[model samples]
Target: MKLTLQILTLTSILLPLSYPIEFNYPSVFNFGDSNSDTGELIAGMGDHLDPPYGMIYFKTPSGRFCDGRLLVDLLMDAMDLPFLNAYLDSLGLPNFRKGCNFAAAASKILPATASDLSPFSFGIQVSQFLRFKVRALDLLAKGRKYEKYLPLQDYFEKGLYMFDIGQNDLAGAFYSKTLDQVLASIPKILEEFETGLKRLYDQGARNFWVHNTGPLGCLAQNVAKFGTDPLKLDELGCVSAHNQAARFFNLQLHALCKKLQSSFAGSNVTYVDIFSIKSNLIANYSRYGFEQPITACCGVGGPPLNYDSRIACGQTKVLDGSSVTATACNDSTEYVNWDGIHYTEAANQYVSSQILTGKYSDPPFADKMPFLLPIKF
Candidate 1:
C-alpha cells in the first residue's frame, strides 16, 4: 500500500500541466498607422489599395500596405487570436469579440497630419476606442445580449493596449520642416504620446506595448528620396541621416517609457526596440533568408533601388512617357521590402518572431504575470 501511494504521487508530480489558459485581457486593442492597419483606412476612406498589394498571400487586396500580413497580424497569430478587424469595417461588426484594430494608413500621431480625407489621426483612433468602450458598457448595463461578445466590466483595464505609431509623424516633420525643426518637434510628439497614454490610463488601461520607430533611412523610399551622395549612405545603402533621426526619436521614447512606468504604479508598459531588430535584418539579410534587403520588391525605377516616390505600389503611371506599373517581384519571400516603405510578409514574420521572443521587449512579456484563468490546473 505504501509503495502504491508513492507511485501515484510520483505520477501526479511528473505529469505535465497542460490546459487552456486565458490571457490577462480577453481582447487586444491595437492602435497605429499603416504598420498595423488591417483595413481601417480603406473602410473609412475609399479603396486606395489595389491589386498586387495582397497578391502574395490573400490573392486580393485586404487593405494592407504589405504584400501579405503586417507584424500585428503575425502577433495576433502568435497570441492564438483571430485577425483583428478594422473598427471601421462595417462587415466585421460581428467579430469584435477578440478586439478591434484602430490603425489608419498614413495617419500621424500629431493632429497636423489630419485632413478632410484622412482624418483618423492617433488621437481620433483613441477617441474611437473610448466610444467603443462606452457603447459596450451601455449595452452591458442594459442587460442586453452583448455579454457573449463584450466583457461586462474591467475589460479595458485588462485588455492589452498596443501602439505602433510615430513613423508618419517623423516622416511628415522631416519632409515639411528642416532637420533642426524636425529635431525640435520630438518633445511635442512625445508629449502627445504621453497625453494619449494618460488618457488611456484614466479609462482603466494598464497594460501597454509600445513599438519604437524603425530605421527610416533604410526604407527604399527614404533612400530614393534622401540618399543622394555615397558618403551619406550606410554600408547597407541606407541614408545615415534619416537613421540617426530615428535613433534619436527612439532614445527619447525609451526615456519617456521609463518615466511612464514610474508614474503609473500598477501599469505594465513595455517599449519594443524595433529599430535594432530591423537594423540587424538589414545588416545580415542572409541570416533571415532575405536576398534583397535594400531594394523594394514592387517598384518602377532604380539605379540603386527601384522605388518611385510619386508612383505608389499597385499603380500605373507614365514615367518618362513610358507607361510603367509598380509590379510585384516574382518572389516576395526572398525580399525584405514589399513596397518602398512597408516590409514583405516574410520580413514581417521574422520581425514579429523577434518581437515576441522577449529579447527586445522591455521587462520581457513572459516574465510578466500570466492572464488569470477560471479553470485552475
Candidate 2:
C-alpha cells in the first residue's frame, strides 16, 4: 500500500511538471540501451556502425544513427557539458573525458540477457564506464586541467548516471539464433544487474536515471516483421508475449532496486518509470504532434519498421535490396518513435523535460532518477 501511494503521489507531481523548467545536469554518464546510445556501440564494436549513422549530427555517422542531434547532445547543451565522447574514440588514457557513454545499441539489464547482444553487454558497459573513470582519474592525477575539459562536480555533487535498457534483451534474443532456453535464464539476468549496481555504488555513483522497459509488442518492427500476416500491421499494433517479458523484467528491476538500497546501505536509488512514459508517448503520439507513432523513419516497409532489420548497423546484408522486409517512415519528428524499438530525439526531449522538471522521478523509474529538478539545487 505504501509503495502504491508513493507511486501515485509521484505520478501526480510529475503530471504538472511536464512543462519546461530551468535545470542543469553536469556530466551525464549514460548507461543502458540504445535510447541514449549516442555512438558508443558503433565506435567500439566492429559489428556496429560508422558514417551513415551520424549524418544527422555531423554530416557523417559519428556513430549515431540519426539525421540530427540526439537527446544526450541536447541535454549536454542544456547543462553546458561537452558532448559525450565515445570511450573508444579516445584511443588512450590521456584522452579520457568525464562523460563517455557506455550504452550499446542492444544492451540489456542483465549480463545473461546481454550475452546474446553484441559487444555492449551490461557488464561490458559497466566495465567501460569504470575504465573511463579510471582513465579520467589518471588524467586528474597527471595534473591535467581535467575540470576544464569535463566540468560538473563543482555545480552538482550528484553526477548523473542515466541507465536505460531491457528492450533489446527480448528483441535481439528472438531475432538471434534460437533461444529455446531463454525463459529459464531470467533469474540469472536479474542477478547480473544487481552485481553491476553494487559495483557502481562502490565507485561513488549515486544519481541514477534508470529507465524501465517500454511497450515492446507495439513496436512497428515487432508487429510488421514478426507477424505472420503479409499486409504489415500499423502503429496501433504489437506482441503480447514480448511486452509481458518487458513488464516482468521491470518488476524484477524495481524489486532489485529496493533490495539493493537495503542491502548496500547509504545509497539513494531513483527508479524512473520510463516504461510508462514511453508507452504513453506511443499511446498519445497524436498529442505530441506525431503523425505516425509506430514505425521508423529510415526504413521502407511500413509503420513500426526499419530500413533493414536483418543486418546490424554498418554491416551489409545479402537480401534483395528491394524486398519490403522492413522500411523507414518519413518525418521522424512527427512520430514518437524513431525506430520501432527506439524513441525519436523529440520524444527524448519531451521525456527529459518531464523527468528533469520533477514531474515523474519520484514515482517509478524516476525513483532512481536524480532530483535534477533544480538547476542549482
Candidate 3:
C-alpha cells in the first residue's frame, strides 16, 4: 500500500500503545531549520511557496518543504501529541500543551554566517523559546488555568528539548568555501552548538535529543552540484568528499555529546546518528522500496538527475528563454529525495521509525533515566 501522511499519522498513534511503560515527556520543544519546520517560515515571512509543494498530503502548502509530515511531526504523533504549531503562526499559541516548534526554513546554526536563505539562526530560535517560557509562566501566575496546559514548575523541567540543526551551516560553508575550509570551521560550529545546549540546560531543560548532520553527499542537491566527476562519486552516486565532511562532523558531535553528558549531571543528553541511518538507507534503497535513491522526485532543467539549482520545486521560470516548470514523479514513494534537498514522506517515515527505536540514539532512548520505550511502527 502507498504510504501517505494519513497512514503515517495512524501508524504513529498506534505504535506507542504496544510499547512498555516509558518516558512520556510532557511536551516537546524543537529547534532547527527546514527539516523540522512545520510552518514558521511561511507564518513569519510570508514566502510564496505555492501549489504542488504540499500536494501529497496537506493538499495545500503547509510551509513544510516536503510533500508530507517531517520527522518532528511523526515523533510528536508517536507520543500521542498534536503536531506542534509554528510559534509565529497567526492563529496564536492555542496549544503549548504539546509544545511549539521554533524551527524556520533556511535557518542556520550561527547568525553571523547564515546565508540569505536562512535569516533566523539557532540562537534566535532558542531566544524565542525563552520568551515563550516567560509568557507561559506569567499566564500561569495570573491564575489563568488552561486545559491540557502544565504548570510552570513541571513544564520547564519535564519537556523534551530537540535540536536538528547544523545542515545549513555546512551547506553554506561548503558552497562558499573549500572542503578544507569547511572542515576547519567544524570546531567553531560545534562550539556554537554546545553554547546553545548549555543555554537550554541552564534554563531547566533536562531531556535533550541532538540530531547529527545527515549524509549530505547523498542528497540530490549535492550530487548535482558537486558530483560531476565519476571518481568523486560513490557507489551510490553520492559525492564521496561531501560524505566524508559529514562523517567528520558527526564524529565531533558524538564526542561533544559525551562531554555534555558529563557536564550536565542528572540530564539526558543523547546524540542521534542521523548520518549513519540516512547513509544506510541510500545504500540499501531497494530494501526500503525506493527505486530512485539519489535523484529528486520533483525537479526540472537538468541531465542525469534532472535537478536544477536555479529552479526550485513547484516553481516556473524562464530557463534559456524557455519556460520550465519543475514537475514531480508519478510515485513519490519510489523516490527518497523530494526536491534535491529534502526527503520524501516515505523516507522520513523510515528514518523516524529508526529514531524512535533507540538504536541510533547515544545512551539509547530506552536506557535513559526516564526509560523511553521503543516504538513499533
Candidate 4:
C-alpha cells in the first residue's frame, strides 16, 4: 500500500499541467544522430533489428538504440506529445501530425558517404524535413480528410526544432586525426551546423532547443579503445584527449547558439549544457543510484568497461570455436552506458529529469518545471 501510494503521488506530481506559463510547443521536429534517433537507421537501412534493444519499454526492438525511451522521448512526453516517427518509416503509414524524427545512428553534422553507417547527415535531415513539410502541406491542401494524418502548414513554425547531434563528428575524427587536428576541425563542423540552423530558420522554424555534445571520453567504446595508455586516461579512467576535444567542441557550439540568438530576432534559441549534466552524472553515479558509470551494460568483455567493438549487443559470433553472444546486464538500471556508444534508459531518464529542472538550459525556462523537484527514481 505504501509503495502504491508513493507511485500514485509521483505520477500525479509529474503530470504536466495545462498552465498558461509553460512553453506550448504543439509539436517537435528533431534532428541528430543515434542519441535521439527513433528508428531512422533501422527503418532506412534494415539494421539493428534484434532483441534486448527495446526489451524494457516496447518489449521488442523499436528502432531506438537504447533499451527504452531516449531523452527525446521523455521530453516529448513532458510536452504532452506523441513520440515522433522516423521520417523514413512508412510501414503503417505513420501519422506525422505531431512531428517527425530525422535523426539516425552514425549521423553527423557534415555530410556522410555511402560507406558511412548513416547517410542522413544534418543537411540531409534538413532536406528531408523540407520535403516532409511540402508533402504534408500538399496532403492538407487536398481536404479535411488528411488533417488527422499530417501536420498543418503553420505547425512547422509553432513546433520546437530540437537538435542533439555533433557527438559522432568529434568521436569519428579521433580515429584518424591528431588531437590538434580534431580540435581544428571544430570550426568547420559548427559552420555546417550554423548553415543548417539558418536553413531551418528560413523555413519558419522559430523555437530551437540545442543540446551540446557530452563527454565522449567517458563512453565505454572510447575508454576501451583509447585508454590503453595510462598517461592518456584521466582520473575518472576516461580518455583525456577525447574529453578535451569534446569540451572544446561544446565551447564552440555554445558560442554558435549565442550567435544565432542574436542573428535572428523573434527566435527563442536555448542552448542546453548536456556535457555538464552527463559529466556530473558519471562523476556522481553512486549518488544517482548507478553502479557502473563508464561501463556498458549490453556488451561483450567484462570488468572496468565491458565493451568490444568486434561484437555489438545481441550479436553472436564464433570465437576460438565457441559462440560468444554479447548480452544485456541482468539489471540495466544500474548502468549508465547502454552499448558503449549510447546512454542507458535509466541514465537518459535521469538526464531528462535534470533537463526538466531548467537548470541546464541557458536563459532557463524560468523554473517552469518545479513539479519535478520531489520526484525521484
- Write down the TM-score of every candidate: 0.89, 0.75, 0.92, 0.95
| Candidate 2 Cα misplacement greater than 4 A, ranges | 1-26, 46-59, 78-80, 91-98, 110-117, 145-147, 150-157, 175-184, 229-235, 302-308, 311-330, 363-377
User: In candidate 4, how many Å is residue 8 off?
Assistant: 12
Instruction: List model 4 lDDT by residue over 4-32, tens digit each.
Output: 23443366456645435766677899999
Error of 2 at 55 (Å): 5.0
**Candidate 1: stretches off by over 4 Å:** 1-23, 92-94, 113-117, 368-377
Tens-digit per-residue lDDT, 45-77, candidate 1: 867697899886789999899988899987776
Error of 3 at 352 (Å): 1.0
**Candidate 1, 350: how far from true, in Å?**
0.6
Query: RMSD in Å for candidate 1, one decimal?
Result: 8.7
Best by TM-score: 4
The 10-residue segment of model 3 with minimum total lDDT is 367-376
Task: State each model's CA lDDT, in order.
Answer: 0.81, 0.60, 0.81, 0.87
Per-residue CA lDDT of model 2 for 159-220, tens digit only, reads 77767776776666666533344445666777877778778878887656666777777776
lDDT of 3 at 1: 37
